[model samples]
Target: MKITDDMIDYISELARLRLKDEEKESARNEMEKIINYMDTLNQLDTTGIEAMSHAFPMKNVFRKDEVRPSADRDDILLNAPDKKNGAFKVPKTFE
Candidate 1:
């Protein structure tokens, strides 16, 4: 696909980008190169190749979810700047 000046203008408008007269040509050339590279890649044969989400295998690194003791509610409420009825009080956010 060829990148034209009109296409660049449309893309710039959609992206809310302000491309100068001098920069339009440069942007067009760069976009053309990217599209050409994608086209070249599409021409490659990938029969029997399995689809992968990443180049390397992925594993969960998070710790196991185990039940643990927590601090007292009175101890946590002591840190609050404003507390009423054992709960933190804040200004109303919505009318």
Candidate 2:
């Protein structure tokens, strides 16, 4: 999975990147290191380990939903910069 200079060039072209020779070399080395690390991880043994979505045990901790009294309409509308007939108003932009 080592990234070659040609591969780096192709990726740069696809991404529309303009890279100097030094940058291309740097990218190639970094990509190679990432592939090597993945190769190292693949060598680990986990024969009976169960796959899990979460690292720790978890349960829903949400509070029960309940309807509550709301503020008066006029009080809430007071914060609006522009209002019309108890509704927020905005400038019309198009026909």
Candidate 3:
């Protein structure tokens, strides 16, 4: 698709960008190049290839969950500036 001045203006407005007269042409060229690259990529044949979210496989780094003894409640509460009913009391976020 051809990138026009109207498209550039609309995109800049949507993105909250204030492009100068010279910058508009630069932005339009960059956008056109990106669209052309995407079109080139779409021409590739991938009949049986499975779509993947990542280029390489990802593994969870989290340790296994295990039940364990915790510190004494009174001891933990002793350091609190303001706590009530065995829980940390914080200021109201909203009225």
Candidate 4:
């Protein structure tokens, strides 16, 4: 389906976008081309092809979780702009 100027205007309004005339024209043509491509894809026959989550082979690539010694509290708190009781002290917003 070809995207019309009216469709572009409606889409822009719906999306709260302020597209220029040139931008609107460009978007309209791109959208029409995408719709045409989808229409073409609809003509393809995929009776036996199984739908897979990924296009390529994939495997779990996770590292084993392990406990490690962390830096001392003093070392971490040294960089704080305003710290109190080994924690950052920001100004309270509420009364």
- Screening candidate 1 with a backbone cut-off below 3 angstroms (N, C-alpha, C), the clashing residue pairs are none
Instruction: For each candidate in the order shown, give its overall lDDT on alpha carbons.
Output: 0.93, 0.88, 0.91, 0.90
Instruction: Put down candidate 2 lDDT per residue, 1-84, tens digits, no spaces.
Output: 868888888888999997999988888999899878888867889889898988899887998689887999999999999999
For model 3, residues 2-95, the per-residue Cα lDDT tens digits are 8999999998899999899999999899999899878887688989999899888998789779988999999999999999999899999899
Candidate 1 has an lDDT of: 0.93
Candidate 4 local lDDT, 19-63, one digit each (tens) = 997998899999999888889876889899998999889998998
**Tens digits of per-residue lDDT for model 1, 1-95:** 99999999999999999999989999999999998888987788999999999889999689879998899889999989999998999999899
Best-first order by lDDT? 1, 3, 4, 2
Backbone clashes under 3 angstroms, per model: 0, 0, 0, 0
Error of 2 at 23 (Å): 0.8
Task: Give, for candidate 4, the lowest lDDT window spanning 10 residues.
Answer: 35-44
Q: Give the residue spans of candidate 3 off by over 4 A.
A: 46-51, 54-95
Backbone clash tally (model 2): 0
